[model samples]
Target chain A: MASNKEDVKLLGMVESPFVSRVDIALKLKGVEYKYEVENLQNKSEFLLKYNPVYKKVPVLVHNGKPISESLVILEYIDETWKQNPILPSDPYKRALARFWSKFIDDKIINAARKALYTHDEKEREKGVEEIEEALHLFENELKGKFFGGDEIGIVDITAVLIAYWLPIIQEAFGAKLFTSDKFPKLYNWSQDFNNHPIVKETLPPRETLMAYYKGHYERHVASNK
Target chain B: MASNKEDVKLLGMVESPFVSRVDIALKLKGVEYKYEVENLQNKSEFLLKYNPVYKKVPVLVHNGKPISESLVILEYIDETWKQNPILPSDPYKRALARFWSKFIDDKIINAARKALYTHDEKEREKGVEEIEEALHLFENELKGKFFGGDEIGIVDITAVLIAYWLPIIQEAFGAKLFTSDKFPKLYNWSQDFNNHPIVKETLPPRETLMAYYKGHYERHVASNK
Candidate 1:
């Protein structure tokens, strides 16, 4: 458990799924910390100083040392706090968790981003195909209730984008990429994940997310036109 | 130390820098393992079974369980072997190492690949600019003799591409993108990294890599035309 003496601060934006990941991890570990929301357009000097390389949010500053990258921060939080272990104990299982977490980020998220945002019809179609294929793999891999096998682990944490943000973004764009019919298992898993106690509290309200993503989608469409 | 009872096997292709990272980590840990070279053009069923998601090389199979992704494999090896510690002990330091390793993969490698292989002059120039900016960040980060300070660690292991393959790739393409003058610290570090005993053993022969890359570059150019 994190001690009261420890000074932990998270620089993030309310709407970022990445920031939500850190928040959920800290909450799972029963650790309390300061959440300083950053305006993405004009990032603060502190955020830049902390994460000079990427200058992005979800930077976890513990005792004045900054750890950037949400996935990296999740691991750090797990290691530092030790309770409600986010990753598995066995080396092979831990490797599996890391592999799935990375797949979500590299394959699913990237393809979903393209599918939701791209103006080109052909490119958007390709992106949708790629994301479905990637999601199908996840659907096949889900032998248990959740990706974490009855518990919310790193894979489930990293897949927050797929569970929460993807649906909202698709709604905002008036697109149907991830359907319950096509991916029933993944759809169910997302439902369970969203309803998880910690995740429920950590996630932004649906209406708020819808409003934000709608504005973003409209701006993207306007700019393209 | 890995015992003789441990059944370890590595499925890899000779020329891949990603494969070399696993090889170097295995050597550094003094872990005895069988190395099976895979013909990437006609990938074996074994490779497909082990890494169905990516169907890529550098899959580490330990006692029947398989681990894919070079960075994921490196961490698995470090945890399993518990010798020649590839990653730092402290949580914060480990996070930093993960951060930089990811930067090398996501920014530097992606940009370098585009710069080296892109058919369009504008895209190639853009790639060169992106790679240079990314490398400048690395150059600034290199405060010691090595990224790991005194010993070779995961960051240095992941950076094998920049040390060995990049120079050969540039020469094969008849492009001089990574000049020593522009990044003296990174250049010196690369030289040191290349000369390290484990890395020296793990890297493919210079002529062999040059021959392979030259063939690849020619094929790419011919196909683009």
Candidate 2:
């Protein structure tokens, strides 16, 4: 690993899976950086200035230049730091990785969010069905131990939500969508991914995440009533 | 330009701006390839097979390996054929380009689509407002002759819809959202973009697209009534 001297700062909310994705990427690359926790409810001026468009977390500021959006930031990190490359080297394989990463973002995460967060019963049911169908398609793409073969690549990093947050949200809300039996490959992959030393170290404590999601579930139920 | 020997096939619909984005990228790269039209309403089995996840057009098949999504295809083309690079050489600039490209897809295009296609009056009004807001932010990003600083890069290519199709759709639907006076920079960029030789040659004929969108507008109105 290359010794880093560049000034890198991550503006993030600790509980965000998106933030964790950036954190994990930095850890994987062995890049040293400053971490600033942003209170999402009351976003800091620095966060807003860095990411004026979205005003969202997981904004990676490198040498004073800010890059928002976790996936975009991941690509930036991969391109900037050549060590422990996250994406495949081949152009075609890289394209495939980008495709699946996008699928996880556009379809799987969106559906999962709806399933866990939406107040409408019908929409939640539709979200559950949609997530199941999307997961099956994603499951078919998993031919190896990790989406990046033996190593956790961009697709696996992008799918941090599936490995860590989804189960917590599912359990917190008492939603029964993703299961070991229903998606054995994905389940196994998730277990392997979560158990990875880097991932295990980088991820927030399970009990903290559980309490956070459980609070969200409680609030959701209260509002729905 | 490197002499092309690889078999490249693009399965696309004539009227789609997304497909046109890929077409223009290939043309810019000077890559000779086969074009296979797919009727979206009655999709070809080949397209379904290649892009089973999305089942959408603009699937670039390079040496029998399929890559779907226009932006993904654009990056693949840039990487595969290094002749005329579409993205920036620098990582931060590339991230900025990716960010704007995504903003175009996620915010501007979605709002433009809803404004042009939605049957609901309230939704259409909201879409119009949203697109105007989104376009203003995009306009601020324009500091050079083109988004690529003299060449039409990925961000400009991704904004093909805003350039070639939006005017036609606006006219066809008799909606007034994107205007030169309101968004002079974006409007100028659109004009410069559409007037480019490759873009002009690759885009579907004006009359054909106008008629197509007009038909859609008529049907939308009829259905609402």
> What lDDT tens digits, residue by residue, belong to model 2 across residues A1-225?
445568999999778999999999999999999999999889999999999999999999998999999989999999999999999999999999999999988999889989888988899889999999999999999999999999999999989999888888899999888899999999999999999999999999989989989999999889978
TM-score of the A chain in model 2: 0.96
**RMSD for each of the candidates:** 1.3, 1.5
TM-score of each: 0.97, 0.97
CAPRI docking class of candidate 1? high
TM-score of chain A, all candidates? 0.97, 0.96
- Residue-wise C-alpha lDDT for candidate 1, range B1-225, written one tens digit per residue: 667789999999889999999999999999999999999889999999999999999999999999999999999999998977989998888998999999999999999988988999999999999999998998887878888889998999999988888999999999887879988888999999999877888788999999999999999889886
lDDT of 2 by residue, B1-225 (tens): 545568989999889989999999999999999999999889999999999999998999998999998889999999999988999999999999999999998899889888878878899889999999999999999999999998999999999988888888899999888889998889999999999998888988899998889999889889887
Give the DockQ (2 decimals) of all models.
Answer: 0.95, 0.94
Those runs of model 1 whose alpha carbons end farther than 4 Å from true positions after fitting are none
